[model samples]
Target: MTRFIEIRNGRVVTPSCVIEDGRVVIAGERIVRIDRAAPPSTRSETVVDADGRVVMPGLVDLHGDDIEEQFAPRSGAETDPTTALATADRMNVLHGVTTKFHALAFEESPEDGRNLENAARLARAVDRGAGALGDNRVHARCELADASADAVAALIEEVDVDLVSVMHHAPGGGQYDAESFERHYVEDRNWPAEAARSAAEERSGMDDASQGQRIDRIGELARRVGVPLASHDDKGRDDVETMAAHGAAISEYPLTLDAARRAKALGLATVMGAPNLVRGGSLWDNLSARKAIEAGVLDALCSDYHPASLLAAPFVDTGESLSTRVNRVTRNPADIAGLPDRGRIEVGARADLVIVDPSPTPTVERAFVAGSEVIRASAGSGAAPELPARSRTR
Candidate 1:
C-alpha cells in the first residue's frame, strides 16, 4: 500500500509562485498533488496542519564540507566513518538539506588528515551509509598542486562520486593572498611560522607544467565518468576561461566579481557559499555573495561549511520575490547538480520538503525526504532540536 500524507494550510513556495493556503499531497516517495483547495483527507492519510508556515522544497547543497567536522571533531580526535556519516545525515535533514554533496578534499595534507587515502575512506563510508535520510553524494575536490591525477581518477572509479571540482589552492593566488595564506597555515593549522612560510613559498613556486597535467587528467576522468565538473575559487576571466576549456560547467566560489560575471557569460553555473550571504561578506574578504546576487551573476548558493546557512540565507532581505530567492537554495543547485527528481514541489517530483516558521531566526519546523518525515520540531513548538551527544574516545 502506498503511504499517504497531506500537509494543508501552508504557504507552498514553488519555483514560479507562492501558493497561499496551499495543500500538498504525498503518495509514497513522490508528490501527487499541490493545490490551493485541500483534497478530502481519508482515514488512512496522515494530515498535518502547517498553520500557514512556509512549505518549500528541501535545499540542494552542492559543496558542503560540514561532514569534515563529524569525521574529525578536533585536531587529534577522529570518529569512525559510519558513525560520523550517520550523524551528519541527521544534521543535514534538520537543516532542510535533502541532497548534499560532501565536498571531500584530496590534498597532500597528512598533517590535517585530508589526504587522498582519507578521502577514499570517507567516500566508502558515504557509500556504506546509503540508507541515511538525505541523498548523500560525494563532491571530490581535487587539489591540482597536491594530489596526483592518477590517484584522483582511481578514487573516482573506486567510489560513487557524483561531482568533481578542480582546485588549485597554491599560496599567493586563488582564495589565498600571501598574508592570509601565512595566517591560515600558522593559526588554523597550528604550524610554526617558519614552516608555514617555507610551505607557502614552495607551493607558490610549484611548476605549472605538473599542475596543468594533473588538471587535464582529472578533467578527462570526470568527463569520462559523466560527473559534473566545477572549478573552485576562480580568480578572474582567464581562470574562468581555463576552467571552461577544461569542461567545468559549474564555477564554485569564484573569488572575484569579474570571474563570476565571466563564468555567467560563458554559460557556467556560478555557485557561492550561503554563509557569505547570511554574514553579509566573505570570511576570506573576497567577493560578496549579496553583491553577486544583486548584480545577477550568482546562479546558486551552497551550504559550504555551514549547513544551517543554507536554510536561512534565502530568507534574508534580498528584494527578490520569495520564489526567486528560494530557488538559490533549491531548484538552481539541483539543476546545476543534474538532479531532476528533487528540489521542487511540483507534481511527480520527489517529496523532499521543509516546513519552516519564519521567526527571527527562521526555524525549520519539520522536514521530509521522499515522503517520509525525517525531522520534526520538538513538541510541535517549532524549536530546533538539541544537538546530538558525542561519545568521547580516550
Candidate 2:
C-alpha cells in the first residue's frame, strides 16, 4: 500500500518537448510515471489537479550569494547564520529553486562580513543548514587576491562545497577597471567615496605574480577535493585560457563576449546571471547575457543575487523552445555543477519539480523536492492546500 502524488492536467516540460495536458506521477523520491493521459485509478494516490498550469523541473541555481545579502541586508545589519539561511531557504523555495548553490564570497571586502573569517562561518552555516528548505549547498567564491590563500583552501576542506569559483575582484583586472571599481563601491554598493577609492587603490596594487600561485594552489586543492572549479568575470580569451589551464571547468560571468566565446571554445560551460538577461543588461556594463544567448555562448543562467530572477528568466520567450529555455536554469546548471540526479522531470529523475501559473507573469504554484511536498498551492480557486506559502522546495 504505497502512496504517491499524481499531478494531472498540466503542461509538463520534459527533456525534449512540452507535453500539453500531461500527467506526472511521483512515488517516493523519484518520478515514477508520466503520460499524456492518466493511468489507472489509484485510491492510494493523492491527486493534485494542476488545472492547465505548467509543470517544469525545478531550477538549479549554481551561483546565488543571496544568503550573504540575507545575513547582512545593510552595512550594519547582522543576522545570525541559521536565521538568515532559513529566511533565504524560504525565499529560494518559493521562487522555484529546488537546488541552490549558496555562493559565498571569500574576499577582503570593506564590509565587516564577506571576508575569509565570515565567509568560512557562513559556509559552516550552509553545511549545517543543508536541506533547511531546498537542496542547499555551498559554492565558494574564492578570491585570488585574498591575503591567505591557505585559509581559503582550508574553507573548501572545512565544508564539502559543491562548486568552487576563483575570482580577482581588483581594479586592474577581471570585472573592473580602476575607475569602475571605485564607482561600483561608491555608486552601486553605496560605499563612502574615500573608502571606495582606497579599496580600489589597494586592489589595483595586488601582485599579479601571487595571483598565479594562488590559482595553482587553490586549483590543486579543488582537484583533490574533486569539486568543479570555475573562473569568474573572465575579461577576454587570455583570461579564459589561463583559468582553463588551472582547472576551471566553468567560466561564470564572462565580462566580455570574446571571453564567453573563448570559454565555450575551450569546453568550459559559461553561466550568466538571469537578472542580467531579465533586466536587459549588466549592472557593470560588462557582457550582455541576452547577446551571449544569441551567440550561443551561454550555457546556463544563475540567480546571482536575486532569487526571483531565476524562475522568470527562462519564461521570457527568447526564441528558444520552452524546453531549451527551461533547461538553461535547470538541467544545464545541474549537469555543470556535477549534480545529475535532480534537474530533469524524467521518470527516473528525482522529484524536484515546480508547478507554475504563467499569466501576467510566472508564479510557482507548487514545488516538490525529493518527492517531498515543499510547497503546496491551489492553481485555480480554493482547493484546500496543505502547506503554507513559505514551504520549502525540492
Candidate 3:
C-alpha cells in the first residue's frame, strides 16, 4: 500500500460521465487526483500511457462460478487450492474484475462437481489466500433443498463470507417450471430423462412449510453474520415479497419483470446475469436482462458464470450512458455489498481501476487494484484472449 501510480490520456469513466483524455493519480490505495489536463511527468510515480484506452473503476462482481471451475478445470480432475486461486485471480484481473465474489453453491450436485466438502475447501482457499491480485470473497449460495439450516450456519462459522443467498432449485420452484427443470437435468447435467422427470415430480410435492422454515433459519444466520442476504431465481412478486420479509437485501435473477419490479419496490437490489445482456436473452429463457435494463428494473449485473460478460456488459450499447452501465457493475453492486470505498473513479475512492482496449472487442490492457498494477498487457507476454463469441455463452 505504499506505491504511487499515474495513468494519463484515457477516457476515464467518472461517476456521472466520461472524462475524455483524463488523468488519474493514485497514492497507495486511494485515488488522489483526477483531472482532464495532463500533469507533468514526475519521478516518484510509475506512469502508464493509456494510449487512448477506456479508464474506469474496476468491476465489483457479486457472483461468479469461477473458483470451482478453476479448482476443477476438468470433470473428475482437481488441483490444489493455491494453484486454483492463482489461475482465478489472474483471469479476474485480466477481465477488469477487482473484487470478485466466488459463488459457492452448497448443493449435492456431484455430477457438476459441487458438494458440501468442495464448497468448504473453496471457501477456505479464498479465506487463506488473502492479498490476491484482486479482492476475493465468498458468496454462500445455500440450496434449501439439500442443506439444513444448521449445516449452513456451521459452514459460515468455519469461514467468513461476503454475502449469502438462499434458493430452492426444483421444478415448480425457483428458476424453473416442470418441463424446463427436467430439461435442464437432461440437457445440462446429462441426467436420464426418466430420472429427471421423476425428480421433478418428487420436488413438486415437497412441503412448502418446511422450506419456509429453512429460509427463516438461513436468513437469521445471514443477519447474525452481518452480510448482505440475497434470494435467487425469484419467479413472482410474492416470491420477492416473501424473501424481502426475511431481510433479503438483494434479489438475484428474478424470472419475470413483475418480480424485478417488486424487488425494486421492496428496496431490494435487483441483479441479473451479465451473460443475459450479452447473449441477447437468458439461456434458460426466464427473463431477458436487456428487457430488465430497458424496463429500468434491474439494479446491477453479476458475472453469473462468466467473468468475461461483466467486462463486456458495460460497453454493450444498452441505450444507456456508459457511466450508467459501468455503475451497474461497479457502484451499484459495491453499494449492495456494503463496500463504499471501491467501485467509483472518484477522489478518496479505492484506486481499483481498469484500462481497456475496446475496438476489436473489449480486452483488459491494464488493471490496478488498490493502487497496485496487478496486470498490464504486453505483446511479449502474449495478448489476452478476446471476448468469446458463441450462441450459448454462459
Candidate 4:
C-alpha cells in the first residue's frame, strides 16, 4: 500500500538548499525522493501542484515555553495541564513548528514544580497516543541553583527527560540584571515579595566558595545521567571556558561577543532565541541575533517563549530569503540535537514538511508529520493560505 504526494512546482527548501521548480515524493511516512523535477509513475497515488509556492522543512524548536503561557493565561487564571498542552500543540502546528522541545524547568516552589510534573505527564501522555495534536517533546531545563545533586539525579530517573540544560539563574547576574532579576522573582512569577527579596539577598550573600560548590554538584549529576548540557547566557571567555570544561555541547544565548566566540571556538553550537531575531534584539542586554548571524557566531535558533517566532525569524531579514531562515529553525536545531534524518528533505528522511506561501505575508498553508497531513490552512480567510489573525506562533 504505497501512497505518493507530489509537491509540484514549489520552491523546496532544505538544509543545504533552496530549490526552484522542485518536486518532493513522499512514500507513506517518509520522503523517498526530492529533486528539481520528479517524474510521475503509474504507482503514484496523488499529485499536488503548489503553484510556485514556498515549501520547506518543518521547524525544530529546541526550547519552547508554551507551558508557562498556558499556566498563566491571564494574570492569575491557570489552565489545566491537559488543556494547556492541547492548545499549545495546535498553536505549534498551525504556525509550522513540527518539532518542539518544552522547557519544563523545575522550580523550587512546590506549586510550580508540581505544575511541571503535570506538564511532563501530559507530554508523555500525548506522545503515547493520548491525543493526535502535535509533536510535543519534554526537555527538562533544570535550575542548578535551586536543585541539589540528589534532586536532579532523581528527576532524570523519574521523568523521560530528553535534554537536561544546566541553568544557574543567580539573581543580578548572567541573563537577569539587577532590575530584571527583581521582576522575575518578586513581581511577575508570583513569588511572595518578601520571600523573593530574602532569597535574592541570601544568594547575594554567598561568596564564590559556596557558589562554586553548588555549580559543581549540579554539573556532576548532569554528567552522570549523560544528558546534553547547555550553558545559559555565558558572560565572557572565562564563562565559556568553564562551560566547555563541563562538556557543554550548546551555548544557549551567550550574552557577550567574546563568550559567543569562545563557545564556537570550543566547538559548542550557539543557539539564539527566535523571538530575539524577530524583535530585532534581546529582551535582556544580550547579543543581537542579526549581528550574531552576520558574524557567523550563531548556529541554531529556538522558539524560546514563542513557537511562531521560529517562522517569523527567517522573514525578518529577507536578504537571506525564506528557505535560508527556515533552515536556521529546522536543520540547525536537529543537527544540534543530534537528529540527522528528520530535519532535511532527502531520501529516507522522515516526511516532516510544511507548505507555505510567501505572498502578501508569509504563512503556513499546510503541515505534515510522518507524511500525514496534520494541519491545513484555515478556509475562513480566503486569503490563499495566510496565518490566521488570532493564530500565534510565538
Residue-wise C-alpha lDDT for candidate 3, range 290-380, written one tens digit per residue: 9998899999999998899999999899889999999999999999999999999999999899999887788888787777677777733
Stretches of candidate 2 off by over 4 Å are: 379-394
Considering lDDT, which of the candidate structures 2 and 4 is the better prediction for this target? 2
TM-score of 2: 0.94
**Clash pairs, model 2 backbone:** 369-394
lDDT per residue (tens digit) for residues 284-343 in model 4:
768988888888798889988887788877778647765567778888898887677787
How large is the C-alpha RMSD of every model relative to the true structure?
3.8, 2.4, 4.7, 4.2
Task: Tell me the TM-score of each prediction against the true structure.
Answer: 0.94, 0.94, 0.93, 0.88
Residues 223-275 of candidate 2 have per-residue lDDT tens digits of: 87898999998999999999999989999999999999999999999999999
lDDT of each: 0.85, 0.85, 0.84, 0.73
Poorly placed runs, candidate 3 (over 4 Å): 41-43, 192-202, 379-394
The lDDT of model 1 is 0.85
Candidate 4 lands at a TM-score of 0.88
